[model samples]
Target: MTTLPQFALTVLGLLFCAGDVAALALLLTWQERAPSPDARRLRLLRGVLPASALLLALLLLAVVQLALL
Candidate 1:
């Protein structure tokens, strides 16, 4: 019952989510090894990025689902 556009949108959303996760993973690993004094800023980013990405991806998927309906 799924159309091509719907399928594509789902894939896009998953990819976006995966990309954000990968980028965050890379940042975490790199930051851990690097000597940095801005640990507080990193902690703030660690809190913010994933939540924002999840919200945006969910919003995109919601819009796509509404379009299909």
Candidate 2:
């Protein structure tokens, strides 16, 4: 099987990380506008942020590994 190049993987990982950052920013902005934001919404955002971070980390690691190869 052919393997993809490192630079490509790194770029892809960065794109994913950027998306996560964007989502987090949107959530923060929404929270600021909310008048007594719903507890459930806050809880969901709490969960989403960590999960997204984890995903970004994993992708970054993959990119690094590919680069090293």
Tell me the TM-score of each prediction against the true structure: 0.50, 0.49
Clashing pairs in 2: none
**lDDT per residue (tens digit) for residues 1-69 in model 2:** 335565566677678767757766775565566566585477557765676577667657756765676
* Superposition error at 62 for model 2 (Å): 7.3
Model 2 CA lDDT for position 9: 67
RMSD of 1: 5.2
Instruction: Write one digit per residue (lDDT tens) for candidate 1, span 1-69.
Output: 668877787777667666756766765666566456587467547854666576667666765665665
Off by over 4 Å in 1: 36-69
TM-score of 2: 0.49
Off by over 4 Å in 2: 1-4, 37-69
RMSD of each: 5.2, 4.6
